[model samples]
Target: MTDIKATVFIPTYYGEDNLDELFTALSTQKVGFEYEILVIDTSSKDRTPEIIKSWEPKFKHFRYETITKPEFSHGRVRQQAAEKARGEYVVYLTQDATPAHDRWLYEIIQPLERFPQVVGVMGKQDPRTTALPLLKEEIIRTFKQFGPDFGTTLFYEDDFIDSQQLFDLVTFYSDVNSAARKSVLLGDVPYQDIPYAEDQKFGEDLIRHGYMKAYAPRANVWHTNEIKLRDYKKRMFDEIVGVRRVGKTMDPISILFVIKQVIRAVTLGSLFILKDHQYTWKRKLYWLALNPLFVIEKWKGVRAAIAVDLDDEQTIVKQSLESNEAIAHGKQ
Candidate 1:
């Protein structure tokens, strides 16, 4: 019998800033079963290795491996982690995503333990306090669609009428705070070698192949991108391009389309800011005035990304944040 009940796996790049808190939270998990914390580092130039070493003595089963930056691909690296993991259930977490409470590990892995048909489970993500107003609302709104924050929901192939319905209702999976059965990860539905959206693709494959995926709302983590204004367009470009790479089609860019989208986004965003109680009146007014510029930048990014030739890797690399970071670090 396997002594390790679960493996909490994390992939790190320049994660020195987030690793200390994350390790502290992981070390104090309120769990009855045995588990291991395994980290795969992409040769981070920061103090990530030092931080990992500092936390080694805090856990009974903690270890990490290093891979060159150039060798990292989201799906491939994660699949490698699964192969190295010794637990019956492998839980994936990004280095920057911190568990909100001590029970996070237990809560995320429970559905996998209790439900035989549930091959995978995803936890809720709450935005960090420093998150921008738009991003904060989007995070909350996105997770709320799965179910109540305190409840659990499961999705299977039989629940939907068609592939489109399934994609629309249940294909949204995230590795930021998620768990999957070890047998399934190493079997027929292993992660594909994709540049982006691998998590959602895995979810689609699981549900299509007659397995269930679950959402445990209480398994919460803090995650968000505190994007600066100058980088917002690049961020949006990466996002839409990732969606396109996953086989989703975007509307063809046109003058009328751009005009309509910007106007609609600004109007709705302005109303949200005005109605939100989290922001002070001055902040609300600031966002309202700035909403138009953000909306315009968003549409411009979306349009440019949609027009990109999927075969042209050079052009996509220029437009996306993923490649830019690698290039900045001399990894690409």
Candidate 2:
């Protein structure tokens, strides 16, 4: 076998729907480096395992293992896979997120190769066509988070205003589509034992350790899911848990700042929809009505998260906790 330059680590559960297209896209990557894929699956009852076996003949370097659901921790599982990887660079991707194009793998790993100081890099996300209007807007906003400078943008601890700002920046990155140097990821800053947002925790370690991180927009991936109010709230709770587990705290003062942001975002988005020539007034009105709901949902999420952080059990309100647990276990 050729020497592996990069390893793509994916954690999956009931991902039968996207497996075929995902493997096909991975096979088409236009790169000079030899790459391998390592998948750690939570024992799925569906045809997910069968499909993976079927694709083995097609991908010479593909390998996977099965683990029970109880054994799964977002960070720990991926870390387990990374420990087994032999590549110099480790790339993380969710099973459902397909590469936007063949160049995605090539583009994402380029930053790590170009800058020795850049320990990690993240790519842009494009929502699926089946996504709801609210989700589509969110996907656009996430893609635009890096700004116009598509080129490599480095982030350091000093760039932030305060510890909270630094924590927010570090913990906001998603591992859904990202890459890191193997040495740094395994040696100096290994993945933690967080239940969610382990990617952000890794980012925290990077900045604290004085290593740089980069945003590489040229690398694109398709990733999104339509979410109801409860789902959003549940995610917020998990996000808070992740942040606290990594020794970061959200400031009580930032609550006001977040509220201000919500108003500004709602107002600007509503005005844009109203002024756009392509949208009919009825459509404009509908969006205006829905946009505030989105803002309110986010505000609710933050508040619930704060409550979880402050509570003795480190849990959200009891009523909401039951709902979030159901959603987490696929009971809903």
Candidate 3:
């Protein structure tokens, strides 16, 4: 009879294997407030539908719907789900990300309620048991790159002195394990219709609106995608394009950037192998040998994505934010 305090929105495709654990974890969350799970499935071919149906009786406020892949737009579909959500906060999670603890739901939404200035909060991601050794090390390195206090860090618009730092923070926001105010997401700062990185685009808008984005170390999830060399390269390309689209800067691809990043990767990989006591020398050497190939693949991907002509931008990429906003305002 009462509206929920939070809505966990998940857009799932072929996620049958993880659905059971994910729902079980959600059912046992130890939050003080009431919450519901809303799943928008893109017609998964596996047993995902049956798995979801089996759990419906267990969850008091579970809801589900199926949509065709052709009808899906990452930002648009998620926005549609938010529009239908009846909660104070909208929490987004990938189907594979299981709650690290029962306290995850409570901790993830704490920052949003604690500070009016904060519009978004992202949770930490721990590697799953199946994560490769190299991938685990990569995840740890990424967290450290955020800094010593990355666990509970907050990014404010005024704190950034340079455009690059601001861009870095904007693009770093991830929807994998994040929460946002329902009012903010649906009313003032909704996600833009970007093809690849709508989370980053939404984050850019949040920062521009003078809002804060938080990193909740206490709210962590077990999530990882074991990407191979080729997939990693493709991911890098998409990321580079996403950055360019949101930044609206047509700065040409830099040869210096490629060189610098490759060198840095080599240096860091070597240092990590030399210092880490967890792995045997044979394993370290194997990773070191693969590191160069990984670096080269990523560099080539970045270069390729950047070298595309702007005249073909519209055909290759989705409609721009300006176009989306115009459509929202009935101006197109």
Using lDDT as the measure, the top candidate is 1
Distance from true position, residue 146, model 1, in Å?
A: 0.8
Q: Rate the local accuracy (lDDT) of all candidates.
A: 0.85, 0.75, 0.77
Please give the lDDT score for candidate 3. Answer: 0.77
Per-model C-alpha RMSD: 2.3, 3.9, 6.1
Tens-digit per-residue lDDT, 1-332, candidate 1: 64998999999988988889899889889999999999989988889999998888888999888998778888898898889999999999998899999999999998998999999999999988655666777899999999998788998876445666446568788999999998999996788777787887888889878899999999999998756676677788888887788777767778787787668657877787777777888888788777667667767777889888988988888888878888888776
Cα distance off (Å), candidate 2, residue 56: 2.1
Q: Give the winner by TM-score.
A: 1
Q: All candidates' TM-scores?
A: 0.91, 0.82, 0.82
The 10-residue segment with the lowest total lDDT in model 3: 317-326
Residue-by-residue lDDT tens digits, candidate 3, 216-243:
8788898876567756656666667776
Clashes of each: 0, 0, 0
Predictions ranked by lDDT, top down?
1, 3, 2
Model 3, residue 248: distance off in Å is 5.1
